[model samples]
Target: MPVGYFVTGTDTGVGKTLTSCALLHAFAMAGKSAIGMKPIAAGCENGKWIDVERLVEASNVPAARELINPYALVQSIAPHIAARQTGIVINIATVQRAFKALQEMAEVVIVEGAGGFLVPLDDRYDSSDLARTLGLPVVLVVGLRLGCLNHALLTARAIHVSGLSLAGWVANQIDPHMESQAENIHTLQHRLNCPLLGVLPFSEKIAAREYASLLDITHL
Candidate 1:
């Protein structure tokens, strides 16, 4: 059986890709054939692409970019807006196909959603919808900031409403200036019904590899 997970964030720029890559690396380090999927990517680099390129870089080289990021939008906006701009119809079927195909090649798969759980990809599809389609447990990336409690709670509720389980969560402290950050972590640990796989500090100097102890790769 292919072991897989869905990675969503409190919002865009919450280091979902970075966390996803770290999980991939963890699985690789554990001698498992790990793979990653972006499903959709926003924001572009160079003249041609998006964050999926970075995912491709971190993933096992054998998995093609097309396999990881099935949809790469050049426009840096909500996925629905990006889809409309490109006249692309983003939906569950397309993403599900990409996900299923990727599973055929690797034992462990990480599917990273483009933005927040409710950010629309189309009229009827969103990150939650895709996660439901994948039918895997979720690993939410909580961008530790002031309003994270609300965002994380809302996302957790939505995940529950979608009839799926949140496998675990990672707290990436994006706001170094956030006051009483430890309090927020304590609150989340008390409220969230899942494991806190990590509590990452805000740092420009710490490489992803240094935080290996922070992650719980046992689920992989």
Candidate 2:
């Protein structure tokens, strides 16, 4: 059976891609064939999305580009806005079909959601709705910094409210200078009601493969 997770962040620029790649590497390390999916990628350069490229690089299995990233929009902004500018309708069903196809090729699939948990996909559907539609357990990437407490709590609450399991969370230390980092993590561990999968400290450079070894996949 194909099994995996939906990786979402508390907010954008929170290392969702890094976490996704790390998860993929973790699965690969476990001797499982894994692939990464970016259902909706808004940022594009030249012709391809930077994040999707990185995801493909980290996966252990090969999947069709269209299936791996169904919606690769041109503009680097909100998904809904990018869809509008490109005259494309971001359909949940299309993404679902793509996910199903990817499942045929790999034992584990990591689907990375765009932006925050509640970010809009279209006027009618957001990332939350997409997660509900997919029915996958969620792994949140909490960017450790000021105001993370509120963002992480709100995102976790929304995930639960939407009727999905908060499988676990990754603490990505985005701000090296942020005060009371350990206390912040302690507070989240007490309140989030899920496993703290790993704590990623701030690094000037990140190699996803190297970072993958740091994450424990037992809870995942």
TM-scores for every predicted model: 0.94, 0.98
Candidate 2 to native Cα RMSD, angstroms: 0.7
User: What local lDDT does model 2 show for residue 204?
Assistant: 86
User: Candidate 1 — which pairs collide?
Assistant: none
lDDT of 2 by residue, 1-220 (tens): 9997999999999999999999999999999999999999998798879999999999989888999999988888999999998899999999999998998999999999999999999889899999999999999999999999999999999999999999999999999999999999999999999999999878888678888888989987
**Cα-based lDDT for every prediction:** 0.82, 0.94
- Of candidate 2, the 10-residue stretch with the lowest lDDT total is 205-214
Give the lowest summed-lDDT range of ten residues in model 1. 205-214
Best by lDDT: 2
